[model samples]
Target: MNTPARSRITAVLPAHNEVGALPATIASLRAQTIPPDRIIVVSDRSTDHTVEIAEAFGVEAMETVDNAARKAGALNQALEILEPEGFVLIMDADTQIVPRFIERALQEFQDPDVGGVGAVFRADPPTGYLELCQYLEWARYAEQIERTGKTFVMSGTAALIRWQALKDVESRFGSIYDEQTITEDMRLTMTLRACGWQVRSPVECQSTTETMPNVPTLWRQRRRWYLGALQNITEMGWNRVTRRYIGQQVMLALSVILMTTLIGLTVASYAVNGFLGVQPFWLVIGAVFAAERVVTVWDQPWPRRLFAALVIPELIYALILQSAYVGAVWQKLNSSQGEWAHLGTPHKTTEEV
Candidate 1:
């Protein structure tokens, strides 16, 4: 099965009050090596100048009709209206793609079974310590995705998906996107693979997206993400497709617990012994952990490399994420729902991401 070289590609951006970030995102799409045949901005009850900004760029912009499902609902509205006959690119309104992003992603569709190609993303330049750590974290994740050629989830930041896959999901699940889930991309990805479609994250396809500016915001984002993942897998039930996802989540939880225990034991040992009196075995293990951190960010700038070498900064970041994961687990156990109110807010400036 082969898709034509010139098959149409349409881009759909689901936005909510993205007035500040919309222009650059639209500009990036316009500058793509193989720009989309149609660019549509589906606004989900935006109260700001989002629609005006989108129309100002000469791209089609329309508001969602009584949609309360947040981003997923907005995307569903667009798909229902357009019913695109070719590939559909779903991306965040704050994301900016490289000029050749669409071109590289489309190359994957050459295989008839390829349903989606996700982009490897890097965070925008850092303005503060939190942002810098976030950048390093993204860089490390991107490296892993590049090495494996397999992403657990197609990034909601940017992904090019086939029309056939969308149709198949709609036919089976009754919707292009599962509006009830907070992490729409992960759910769609699992559904595609469950239905025998190949989804990949190739090194050649890349994009840049905004990172959270502070800890509370970051906490909300990650908690919602993990909560959604847990809920999605549970809803999908224990199938062959969900087994790997469940294993991954369990490993993450165990790693967090192990790390916390290690830290506690180290602190206790320090209290019982002088600095030089601590055991050599713990020293060797600490050295290895520190080395791994440094190596992971070796390709980054000197400042970030130095940050990784310090080790403590990144460990704090990890702890923050672990705490968020625990909170998500608690929420899931209690049958509490996550909120979509903290969706991407516009940045202050229109600078390129």
Candidate 2:
């Protein structure tokens, strides 16, 4: 019997003022069961000690002058400098990979048809109340990924991509990471599929990442995400008649629109009932929806499950922000370009783990 060959993996970390998160992230990479051949951390105009921290880890640290395209631009800048030879694993500075994350992710690419693979992501443990709420939401995402091999989007926290597949798409689409789009991960995955490649989420690979730990931060983060989703749909041109990718994009857009509209209508009904002395059925409906969400995640542990049960409040918040973002996206689809506000910055600066 012959043993299988090992895969060559290169990990890329795109950093911008991530001094505090850099140490833990680097340590996580160092602690990998099957270590990467090379770890590259691209410092995108950091005003902090991000590059210094990366160098301290004995990893390759490269600094770039421009921070124009945000995370996607940072990633593409890294790609430009690094030679394209093997699998590229792109991760955020705040994300910590599990011991076997890379080892397992590489295994999926052994199947040539798989162009990219996403890992099961969980929020870092011992988080705050709001963070726990975010964790439960991610848990639902993890469940869906496990059930369906097809993932609608690949998380930037931890994703493995075949170099050849990336090159193929980049050659046609101009750049693997689109600087114009806010949700580069979704855009790249969609582009890959458009060019005849399959993207999957593997069950084995897992990564732990930080989540917004407060209501205000979570609101801003989700709003930007919703806005980005709208931009991606328009940029890709949501056409059900032409391609399945377009159809999928359209469905995703409509779902967002529908959910936002439903939430807005429910809220409006509650206000109207209070003003006109009408029945408060909408409030009752909202309560029922909240109860249903709580019931769905009842199997989790005490506090965790309790937190999950209170998802309605979070959902309501998300819907309101998403509705506003959708309107903003509609108005600025042609020229909406901005840096994603770093929500975990406070935690990153204060917390040490």
Candidate number of the best TM-score: 1
As a whole number from 0 to 100, the lDDT of residue 180 in candidate 1 is: 90
* Candidate 1 structure, TM-score to reference: 0.94
Question: Residue by residue across 124-224, what tens digits does model 2's lDDT show?
Answer: 76456566666777777777677666587877778988888889888998988998887788788788887777777776777887776566666656656
Model 2: residues with Cα > 4 Å off, grouped in runs: 1-4, 126-129, 239-299, 310-312, 330-335, 344-353
- TM-scores of the candidates are 0.94, 0.82
Root-mean-square deviation of candidate 2? 4.5
Query: lDDT of candidate 2 vs native?
Result: 0.73
Please give the lDDT score at residue 111 for candidate 2. Answer: 73
Q: Which prediction has the highest lDDT against the true structure?
A: 1
Candidate-wise lDDT, in order: 0.86, 0.73
